[model samples]
Target: MRIRRAGADDAGALALAGAATFLETFAGILHGRDIVEHCRKQHAPQVYADWLDDAGAALWLAETAEGAAPVGYAVIAPPKLPLHDLSEDDLELKRIYLLSRFHGGGVGRELMEQAVAEARVRGARRLLLGVYAGNTRALAFYARNGFEHVGERRFQVGGNTYGDAILALDLRR
Candidate 1:
């Protein structure tokens, strides 16, 4: 697979792959209306385009081959929320999703390596991500990557509220 930093030109692919991977990952937890609405707003091409256009936000896309469709992507940026107790220099891993077919194939490890490297380059003191409390698989993945559950937060998708566990990995020794 080819993994590279995505530019604004990749917005459409990112949006499409993001929606597909999101559905594959979260379909079990969300109701039909909520999932559809959440994906509509959060995975839109325009949203990704905006992120690509932003100087502070970054994304990495993974393709199966040259000029092929994207199978996965990851995003990292400064925190959008002023969550209590996190460092001012904390970086948030807003997303890391791949097609289920690619699981156990090292795609996620590569993505985390790049994302964490970038976060360190940006001088972040820690890396943070909010995962749905129900997603034990994701929690295990993050734990293996040295992230620990630091707290809890509530996330609202459509009319439903879900509990999310905030995980963090300290970048310092």
Candidate 2:
């Protein structure tokens, strides 16, 4: 697989991969209707397009080596979480997802490395992210990467609200 910077033209692929991964990850854990509604809006191509247009945002897409089909993506942007201690030099790992089939193959790690490198290049001191509080696997993954739980917030999905754990990794480490 190859991970590359994503542009506005990649909105569709990003949307597809984003929606697919979201659904795949939350299908059994979250309410089906909530999953559908959440993906519909959160993973829309227009959303990605808008992010692409933002000067402070960056996205990377992971694609298969053979057919170049998008399999995963990661996005980093100016802090949007509800952290009161956020600083101008901080960034958020707004999203990072990969198809389940590609798990454990190092693609996720590559995506994460790309995000961290980009954040450092942009002079960010800390990188934050929010994850479903109940997602043990994801939480463990983040912990392994040196992220520590720092806060919590309510995440809205469709008409439902869920708890989210905020994690932060100090780039100065």
Candidate 3:
């Protein structure tokens, strides 16, 4: 697979992937109707377009082969709290999503590895992310990949309460 920086032209595909993966991954963890509703609002093409232009953001797309379309993506940025308490120069993994078909295929790990490398290049000494408590698969993935639980908080999604676990990986190590 090849990884590359995403351009504004990729907004639509990125949004679609985001919504699809969010829905598929959260199926049982969140109410079906709520998941659909949230994805619709949050994954709009314009939102992705704006994200593409944001100076603080960096998005990477994973493609299967030369000239192949993006099948997965990861976004790392300055952080959106209550997931993090950003210190200057720290990097936050805002979101990481892979098409369900790409799960367990090493794409997610590759994306994260790239993110850490980029963060280091940008002079960040740490990386942070938040995983919903119910997403054991993601939590396990983070744990296996060197992140440690740092804290927890409550998150309200579609008016329903859920636990959010804060995880951090010190890149300086």
Residues 19-107, candidate 2: write the lDDT tens digits: 99999999888899999999999999999999999999999999999999999999999998998898999999999999989999999
Per-residue C-alpha lDDT of model 3 across residues 39-106, encoded as one tens digit per residue: 88888878778879998889988877966666788888886655435688777898898877888878
| lDDT for 53 (candidate 2) | 98
Q: What ranges in model 3 sit over 4 Å off? A: 83-85
Model 2 ranges with Cα > 4 A deviation: none
lDDT of 3 at 151: 81
Q: After superposition, how far is residue 33 of candidate 3 from its true place, in Å?
A: 1.6
C-alpha lDDT of candidate 1 relative to the true structure: 0.89
Once model 1 is optimally superposed onto the true structure by TM-score, how far is the C-alpha of residue 104 displaced, in angstroms? 0.3
Using Cα atoms with residue i matched to residue i, what is each candidate's TM-score against the true structure? 0.96, 0.98, 0.91
Angstrom error at residue 75, model 1? 0.5
Candidate 1, pairs of clashing residues: none
TM-score of 2: 0.98
lDDT of each: 0.89, 0.96, 0.83
Candidate with top TM-score is 2
The lDDT of model 3 is 0.83
Task: Give candidate 1 misplaced runs (Cα > 4 Å).
Answer: none
